[model samples]
Target: MTTPIHVMSEIGKLKTVLLKRPGKEVENLTPEIMERLLFDDIPHLSVIQKEHDAFAQALIDRGVEVLYLEKLSAEAIDAGNYKEKFVERILDESNLETKPVREGLKKYLLSFDTQEMVDVIMAGVRKKDVTIESNHLSDISEEEVYPFFMDPMPNLYFTRDPAAAMGDGLTINHMAFEARNRESLFMEVIMDHHPRFAGQDVSVWRDRNHTSRIEGGDELILNDKVLAIGISQRTSAKAIEDLAIELFDNNSNFEKVLAIKIPNVRAMMHLDTVFTMVDYDKFTIHPGIQKNNGEVDTYILEKGEKPGTVKITHRSDLQEILREALDVPKLTLIPCGGGDAIIAAREQWNDGSNTLAIAPGVVVTYDRNYVSNDLLRRHGIEVIEVASSELSRGRGGPRCMSMPLVREDLPAR
Candidate 1:
């Protein structure tokens, strides 16, 4: 039987993927709370939905099965007969101040059918929208001006962050920020009870229950034997170490973990923001991540002689390290914006380097990064460009918006 989650390589032929179509969650972002919600500006929901549909269709055209996270979450609850359990978990994590408010919110949310309830949670709940007949001073004196009973998850459309698939298992991540922390609950439910995934023997290498943070945006499966994780704003070095130890001790078919450290800044929040694998021996890199000497901090982790320990080696040459990891004699490092400083920064901000590889030499990218797209074509890669005016506002391209569920293994080069 084929595994429900089987992603061993970044450049494999994508068989199935998970995506969240832009919904009211994105529309709920007001200018005041947008930044706090990890969104730059409020996206036009209609336009963003159109663009996202195009993205799903693009994948469908390539023979990739596309699954919607919202639908899957609702289905999982129904399939497992856990609606009450799911709602309770949501309220528990919603940070409702008192038991009275929690119970009131729970009652309000439970009135809807499963799918509507799920969508309402994603869109967030405003205090004004739900009536509570509470005379308690705690509820009466609290700030009424505060917008929501639960904050909207604006980053839900970027399905790559909540969890990531690797080998035959997946990591339901403990996200770095409060804005994204609750997003993984949907993945946990889906993996545990969804009809397509339950009883499938899918492993959870790491769970979202930890305190240390690790995001899927920083996790990249370089090949069957190597993984490249980023130590960046969203992923802590400690999390990388923990994941490495788990994979090594468990025989997860991963032999090496390259912890690539990039500047911990907003624009380059995750490793995939600055780096990604495109083909067997080719990758797209944002020049901003490298020093003047073309150096970047890297730590190679391998199985140690002592059980549960890892052997660590430091390296600064990313190119050489990747070549050795993939076992290719030579490799190509395609710089975002063709290594042009200004264009690189501009395009990289729009996620020019975050290209999703569907097949060996083909990628899905944002059309706004024309220079980067043209350069990729010159490098002998087939580039499929998608509309990004509204989607780009969220600061994620095809790769950031996608989480591959199943991928056909690459033939030997």
Candidate 2:
């Protein structure tokens, strides 16, 4: 039986991918709550959608099949008859004023068809949308003037962070920020209830029930037997340890987990924000991720002598670590913005380093990062540039906006 998910290498030829087109959620960010919503600037909905469509078209033009998260989520709910259960789960997670508010919201949401309900839930339920008769002071009073009954998931456009497809399975993530915590629920529903994957042998390496957070932008499947996870602001070390233990116990082929530590800052919030694999032995790197001497904290995790234990080794030579992991005689680390301090900082903010590799030696990047794009071309890599003037406002690039469900396995040596 063919597995529904098959991603083993970061630079493999992408086959099927999941993407969320910019929706009303893009324009839902208000000045007062934009920061809380994890957006420094709100994108123009029309323009963002145009750019996102162009991005998807580029992928399709390359013989890649693109799927929409919203459509799949709605299908999953309807196929499994999960409308009531879905509403209940959303309400349980939503922090409302009282039971009456919850009941009102549930009823209002249930009134819609599955597709509309999914969109409404993602677009957020504004306070004015629901009417409830509650005697509770909390519900009646104006103590909290928050306009949204449920905050709009503006970051949903970044399909990468919600979940990651590894070898034969995937990890439905528990996001770092509350703003995106519920994002993975959609993927969970898809994997568990969708007709295409309901009974498939898709392994859940690590479910989203844990307290520790892990984001997909920090999870890189280097190869079938090796992975690279970042210990950054969004992904915790404990999460990586637990994932390594789970993988070691279940999957006998997985041999190593490289836990790379980077600065815990918003600019480099994820490993992909500063580092990404572009080719078999080539990678894009933001100079800001390294120290003065080009050292990076990296931990190697493998199976211990005993069951249910992981052996850990700490190393700081990132370049060497990558070379060994990939089994390459030589490695190329292409700096974003051509290693210029000022340009790197400027382009990195727009996710210049976050590139989506569609195939070996071929990647999709933001057209705005001209310096980095030019540098990549000089290194014998084919760069596909897409319109990103509006899309970059989300602080993510092509890689951040896509989640690969299937990638062609690389040829064996």
Candidate 3:
């Protein structure tokens, strides 16, 4: 088996990446369940799958290995005793304990390879009639019922937000909201106990008393020596600080840490939603936050006994500080949404700023964000657009669609 390469840089030679194709879970989102599911609207699964396939195929065409989370989960179930544990974890997290629902869950876990189980785990199992054992609850009538059922997981398709790969292992995030907690559980099992991935170190940052959500979408590995973290609505300052301590406490290769504080707005949910590296010295960014036009702040910390600290108003300014502090050459900033007032505003809302680069100057994007694509094209970057109308309906784009585990650094241009 080929050991997966460690991710040391964003603009690296393409290697292996992970993705979860949208499925029935997306179609199960109803207006009443939208908020609970962390989605603003329901997406057409068929169309979303088609779009996802296009994105995956684009990476495959470039010789990058694309691993599907569903296939991995099914394989894990077949290889270890983790299947039952995963099922029980899901049940406990979702608060489903009725007899019928419990039996249904057991059946679903046993059929991990089937579409039914996939749908149930991703889209969520519906509440059926509740029941109790005759001996256990003799006083309760059948009409009175037993435990309540739970809402289905409609946002599991956003796999990028559940777990993040850092250094030599994976970190299972404690999602900021309850709607996506099931995703974290699924990732935790895969990362910690899967036969194919057994023995790999896995970290879980869950506070029994407080929520410290840290999504992969907000974390970026610029180089082996630097990590750029985004603090936004989905990722908190406390979460970032905790992650920093974890990373710094264990690793000596990392020499600096940079935190880019994004505004807590729906438009800016993660750091990748506003910035991504395209090459050794080049990056794509949203001027609003990257330029400090919005209420965003940038901070940096160096490695030493004292561990010097610095703050700047804009990401560009911060970049300069990093270049000088880390002894790197100039950094380039490519504006997202075309850098035009009207176009930038329009595309940014549609997640134009969110992109996953397969290789230097080559990236995947939503076809809906046309203006951003055009801008990338004009700047000599290759754009492969996925038909994301259905996927975008769920409020995520290319960046949210992928979780890169390994990449090779590109030679300086």
Clashes per candidate (backbone, < 3 Å): 0, 0, 4
Off by over 4 Å in 1: 137-144
lDDT for 45 in candidate 1 is: 92
TM-scores of the models, in the order given = 0.98, 0.98, 0.85
- Residue-by-residue lDDT tens digits, candidate 2, 1-413: 45789999998899999999988887889899989888889899999999999999999999999999999999999999999999999877777768888888999999999999999999988878887779877775643677788889989989999899999999999999999999999999999999878888889999999999999999999999999999999999999999999999996357899999999999999999999999999999999988888889999999988878999999998999999999999998999999898999999999999999999999999999999999999999999999998899888899999999999999998
Assess each prediction's global lDDT (C-alpha) against the native. Answer: 0.93, 0.92, 0.69
Local accuracy of candidate 3 as per-residue lDDT tens digits, 47-74:
7788788888988988988998877776
RMSD to truth, every model: 1.0, 1.1, 4.1
Off by over 4 Å in 2: 141-144
Candidate 1 has its poorest 10 consecutive residues by lDDT at: 138-147
Candidate 3, TM-score vs. the true structure?
0.85
> In candidate 1, how many Å is residue 410 off?
0.5
Encode model 1's per-residue lDDT on 4-73: one tens digit a residue.
9999999999999999998999988888898888888889999999999999999999999999999999
RMSD of 1: 1.0
- Residue 366 of model 1 has an lDDT of 96
